[model samples]
Target: MADIQIRKYRDDDAEAVKEVFTLGMSEHIPSSFMHLLKQPPTQMVFMCVFCALLASSKSILLPILAVTLLLAGARQLVSYMFNSYIDTSLKKDLNYITETYLEQKNSCFWVAESDGRVVGTVACLPSENLPECLELKRLSVRRSHRGTGLGKALSQTVADFTRDRGYAAVVLYTSVVQTDAQKLYEHMGYYKIREFVIPELAAKILNFTLIEYRLNVQGD
Candidate 1:
């Protein structure tokens, strides 16, 4: 988060927001463009040929040809998707949770930006079906930018947000693999309340175990 100016998201922030969402992960590349370029030589040549065909002068059915060639181009790039293991299966689960949480209109979303690049984000949701509790989700800082207190800043920001919204407690879940994050959560006053093999936690156990932590925001 690195002294970022935090604020609500704008429509122009789609790409930056996606970048912040993916930060601090070994499997993640800067962009899908980078992910495409890192492919093997054979795949690279295939992509080049397809792009050439896409720009050919003798093309009458260019649109159809483009779609056909693009599918082939996609096949060449499909391996990258397999190479990256999406921990937490967070993409799908995140979308689901965000949608549900937003429907209630009780969650807050914050984005951190530094030098025009988004480096971090924190999101809060009312916990489960509980009206008085909140769950912090998607708190992250870029790997190259850790130890700058963005995590704590996001936590405190979310805490204040929940308090302002009248929530009595704030809770969140983290992976056992993320020791630093667990420590940070604890340092920020979140306690390990329950441990279980829920879908998201179970997905992490395939790579590393996970624990759920809760913080009593009202107590503060």
Candidate 2:
């Protein structure tokens, strides 16, 4: 779409901003669940053992029922953890967008508008976890708007902000599942410097890791 405007978020854009972020994040749940299921310790081991029990035993009803319960439990556990993450994150940070991302001299939230609607979002602020660097957060683009250069535009916006302010670097974290995001970061000259295992059960079961990427900035 033409006229893709990247500007600071306004008061009226709160609802749209929340919607894009929520929906964008929710899109990963299905893939995450599927990944968890394939892990040998989660569903695969149980299923295999249940199958063996059924084949060898004459009275299989009770054993098969137990297997069914076990499988259901594993599935529910993943669901609960993912939903809890969404809830806690929204309450801890998303609800205070203005304060967390928009109020400080070094912090800003930006939305991408095309045809008078916000289809993408991004934010950056001084890193609390890292010194002398800015942290990029919540970079999301609606599905229909992907590959239209909005992602690059949003990223460059944060990099420009960091460079202008003479921050030593700009850093971000993305899940290992987000291949597209990794590609974009690398294309933009960001490189993976570290990786940390996610603390959630579902994430650990699936071997999910969070990759940290950084772009060193120089003053002009």
Candidate 3:
């Protein structure tokens, strides 16, 4: 913590920032796959397929193999979903951090550096859907640097930025799989405003949900 420095995003830090984000998002693949497996639809389909295969082939090995393959495929789908999001973000705002968060009004990006290497990132911008509110996005900390109050420090950075800009509140969205993030935001005085499933065929089938949380800085 003594070596960590939180400051504005710089051009040279682009690659490091993206790496932190990609790695952070990739770390959730296992949990997301587990979440998919726990869904009722996923369980029902796997059970039906396994029973059908077992009855038809009259071979436990074959059914087990088939189920294992299905599980692997499901895990691949979860990985694909997370990878796609990473790619999209890279191609979008992340690809143009300076313009998206630095040059714009009421928008900014920050990175945490430790011994001259970027280890964490967080950004905020005016919310598209919520008036007088700023949306916190891209909050990520390197795995090796987690559990040292870095996440809370980054979150508080956003809250302080929002308050300084006269924003009423700060809103952020995190997937249901990110339990730790939810807890961190809650501990920072943020409240759950709503939850919604991603409107994609695969996401809908898997019941993938995103939760929105809001921290009121104006009143506090």
Candidate 4:
């Protein structure tokens, strides 16, 4: 770990972060799941809401509703079917840094480098709506570097950054399915604040729960 150095993301880091992001996603969720997630926002949300309406209503519009649901479901199926044929691609981890850095706010990225390569990264962005809360995201470590305390160090760096910005608290959300992430948050002094899920996907997926975790940075 001596060779591992953490530094802020520069414009040159864009492509590197994208590569890391892709690597992390490929190592995690199934390709099928990523397909549904990557669907066009308009189509995805429309189909989700369409399903919700169809489940609750049974009236003269049932035929139209049924057709829409069938089409949406078929689209989802097609998306998954063709997903394997495309060249390998992964979610861009640069999303976190691009969002924050572009805002010109107190948002930043920390890259863990070793042997002249980026092994991991953590990103933090101050909450615009909730001043006391800092939003942390995109904490990822390469597979070969796990269990070497890099994650903890990345988290603590975010905590320190939040404290330095005079924030009283830090807040983040992670899927309940990620038990390891929950454990890490708890270990970092973040307590479970609430558990809820968006009504649309709540019944479609496993567990269907999202946990909000928070930590007091100013000891408040």
Arrange candidates, best lDDT first.
Answer: 3, 2, 4, 1
Off by over 4 Å in 4: 30-99, 199-207
Best candidate, TM-score: 3
Give one digit per residue, the lDDT tens place, for model 4 in 1-220. 7778988876667777766765665443453344345547535665666666677785537746665676567556544433431223223335445555545577878888888788888887877567778888778888788788888888898899999988888788776546677888898899998998535442233224568888898874
lDDT tens digits, residues 1-220, model 3?
A: 8889999999999999999999999999999999999998899999999999999999999989999999999988998898999999999999999999999999999999999999999999999999899999999999899999999999999999999999999999999999999999999999999999999877887799999999999896
Q: Who wins the lDDT comparison?
A: 3
Which is superior by TM-score, 1 or 3? 3
What is the Å distance of residue 79 in model 1 from its true position? 12
Better of 3 and 4 by TM-score: 3
Q: For residues 44-156, write the lDDT of model 2, one tens digit per residue.
A: 67877787777778668966887888767767776676677778867877778888887777999999998899999999989988878899998999999999989999999
Which of the two candidates, 2 or 4, achieves a greater lDDT against the reference?
2
User: What are the root-mean-square deviations of the candidates from the true structure over C-alphas?
Assistant: 11.9, 2.6, 0.9, 9.2
Where in model 1 is the C-alpha error above 4 Å? Answer: 1-3, 25-104, 199-208
What does the lDDT read for residue 87 in candidate 3? 95
Question: Model 4 reaches what TM-score against the true structure?
Answer: 0.67
Q: What are the lDDT figures for the candidates, one per model? A: 0.65, 0.85, 0.95, 0.69
Q: Could you tell me every candidate's TM-score relative to the true structure?
A: 0.63, 0.87, 0.98, 0.67
Alpha-carbon error at 136 in model 4, in Å?
0.6
**Cα lDDT, model 3, residue 34:** 91
